[model samples]
Structures are given as C-alpha cells and as structure tokens.
Target: MKRPIRVLVAKVGLDGHDRGAKVIATSLRDAGMEVIYTGLRQTPEMVVNTALQEDVDAIGISILSGAHMTVFPKVMELMKQKELTDVLVTGGGIIPEADIKKLQEIGVGELFPPGTAMKDIVSYIEEWVAENRNF
Candidate 1:
C-alpha cells in the first residue's frame, strides 16, 4: 500500500497563537493525510529541520505575528540548503496580497488567507503532493 501524504504544520517565530494550526492539522488528518504539528514559537531552523526529519510532502506555516516575510523566506532558504526541492512550502495568515505574490515568486506555494475553506486546503496539498512528490 502507498504511504499517506505527510504534512508538517508549523507556527514560526514569536507567534504564540496556534488554534488555526491545530484546526488545519485535524482537518488534514480527517482528509487522510498524516500531519505533524510543531507547536508555537518555533524558529525557521527548527521547523525546517523537523520537516526534514519527518519527511513531509508539504509544510504549512501558520503565521499571525506579521512575520510572514521573514519566516517564509528563511524557511525556503533552509529547505533549499537542505535539498528539499520537492517539498511544497505553503502557509496562511494575515499576509497581504502583494506579500503573497512576493512569497510565491520566491518558490513558496499557494497561500490561503483567513476564511479559506478547509476542503480547499486539503485538496491543494493533495494535488501538490501528487504532482511533485515521487511517493
């Protein structure tokens, strides 16, 4: 049998809020993906290292601390340095449209804003894994 899609859901930096991360983790689990959630106040290094260790197909960052700019790029750089080329790096939070475009330009995947449906998030991750991960 094929292994289930694995995702690492993380809250990077000084963001102590994690309710949304928990909700997304549970929703992804219900959608049949294996989820590993790294709890609050994690650094970019910690998140990426954990992703590498967990061998996740995707990394979902929940950043409400307005550090999306710093956090996403740092994670992307680390992912690159660690040779995680196929791992989808996606996230959601209070990021602005321009910032989202900037992040996507730097290789971050589709980012959902607040109020995005859970089904969409699940499907996006599934589709990304299907297209990118070799399984």
Candidate 2:
C-alpha cells in the first residue's frame, strides 16, 4: 500500500486563533494524510526544522496574524538555506489575493481563503504530493 502523504501543519507567529488550522488538520487527517500540527506561536525556523526532523512531505502554515508576508517568506528562505526545497509550502487565512499570487509565484504551492471547501484543500494536497513526492 502507498504510504499516505505526511504533512506538518503549523500556526506561526502571534496567530492566536487556531480554529481554522485545527479544522484543516482534521480534514487532512480524515483525508488519509498523516498530519503533525505544531500548535500555535511557532517561528518560521521552528516550522521548517520540525518539517525536516519529521520528514514530512509538505508544510501547511495557517496564519491569521497578518504576518504572512514575513512568516511565509521567511519559511521559504530558511527552507532554501537548509537545502529543503523538496518540501511543499502552502497555507491560508486572511491573506489578500495579491499577496497570495505573489506567494504562489515564489513557490508557495497554493493558498486557501475563507470558505474554501475542505474537500478542495484535501484534494489539492493529495494530488500535489502524489506528483511532487518524487523526493
């Protein structure tokens, strides 16, 4: 049997509201991916380190702290620094459309917004990992 995709879902920075992150985690778990949630107030370095240590295929960061610009880019920069280009970085929450596009251009796989159907997020990650997990 194929092993399910392993994802490290984390809440970064001062994002205190975790209701959405928890929801995504549960949805992904139900979709058969092994999810490791790092709870709240995590730094970009910590999230990347945990992803490497856990050997997860993807990193899903849920941030509502309005720090996605800093946090997401920082995570990507550190991932490059740690030679971790293989891990997929995707996330959502209170992010404007313009920033989302910019993030995607810089290699953030995808961005989900409020009311994005959970099934779509699940499918997106599953298909992406299935194709990108060549690592």
Model 2, global lDDT: 0.91
The per-model lDDT (C-alpha) reads: 0.94, 0.91
Worst 10 residues of 1 by lDDT: 11-20
- Return the lDDT, model 1, position 80: 94
Clashes of each: 0, 0
lDDT of 1 by residue, 1-135 (tens): 789999999999888989999999999999999999999889999998999899999999998999999999999999999998999999998999999999999999999998999999999999989988997
Please, what are the lDDT tens digits per residue for candidate 2 over residues 1-135? 678799999999987999999999999999888999999899998999999999999999998878998988899999999999878899989999999988887889889988999999998888888887874
TM-score of predicted structure 1 = 0.98
Candidate 1: segments with Cα more than 4 A from true spot: none
The count of backbone overlaps in candidate 2 is 0
Model 2: residue 130 alpha-carbon error in angstroms: 1.1
